[model samples]
Target: MRIPANRMPTAAAYRPDSRDAGIRRYFGLVQFALIVGVPASRLCSWRHGTHIWVPSPDIQVGDHPGWSMACIDAWVPGGDPFLRPPVVQFADTAAIRARYHGMPASTLWACIGDGTIPRPVVWVDNRPGWLL
Candidate 1:
């Protein structure tokens, strides 16, 4: 049925049949970055690759790159995934001394006192340890 000219629907009320209401079908650059836990600038840089390896965008609209919701779910950053902090390996004085070729306990203590050796990063079971 044809609507009268005076009853014409406004643009805001128009819904294109091509877009399904089931769920969001696509992710904008900003939205993808937010879900991936990175800044939009970083995403753009990664898409083009700031290093030897770069993640390619899943979809492109015009000159801008985008991703489908499905692709976003599977998205992995260029290096070791995005926003993943590096694992810190903690070792106590004895273990640390072993790493330094078994430096003497007295020498290690002197270094610690003289500020040559950095402070411990964590304490477990009342033992101090440095991050390796």
Candidate 2:
């Protein structure tokens, strides 16, 4: 029997599709940095997650009321997939910029502009579905 190329295959098609078995595609590594900070005027409360970006070693944005912003930076891994994978961690703005080395100004900002991408299930350690 001849199969038409335009039609989508059902899961049962995989039973005889040996050509599809050998090739696997890797999406590559993704990293996210969760930043939390507090303003100098407000007492740091562990219950309320808040943080301000520190622009410099001496200048903490937390003190400036006009400058309250909390954010996360995600990094996409580049280079050999087998080697250097994407590195993700919870860190301050400065540390993230340092570790990824200008990734914020480059790839990171572009991604943020693209809009919210869904968080992967592996990252949702405390999500409601898992708690049950």
Name the best candidate (by lDDT).
1
| Per-candidate local distance difference test | 0.56, 0.26
Off by over 4 Å in 2: 1-89, 104-106, 112-132
TM match of model 2 to true structure: 0.18
lDDT of 1 by residue, 105-129 (tens): 8888888889988866543223455
Q: After superposition, how far is residue 101 of candidate 1 from its true place, in Å?
A: 78
How accurate locally is residue 104 in candidate 2, as Cα lDDT from 0 to 100?
59
Judged by whole-model lDDT over C-alpha atoms, candidate 2 comes out at: 0.26
The weakest ten consecutive residues by lDDT in model 1 span 8-17
Residue-by-residue lDDT tens digits, candidate 2, 1-132: 778856734423322235635322111011111222223233223213334222211112212111111111121222121222232222333343455565654554454457432112121111101000
Off by over 4 Å in 1: 1-19, 22-24, 50-55, 78-132
**Predicted candidate 1: what Cα RMSD to the true structure?**
21.7
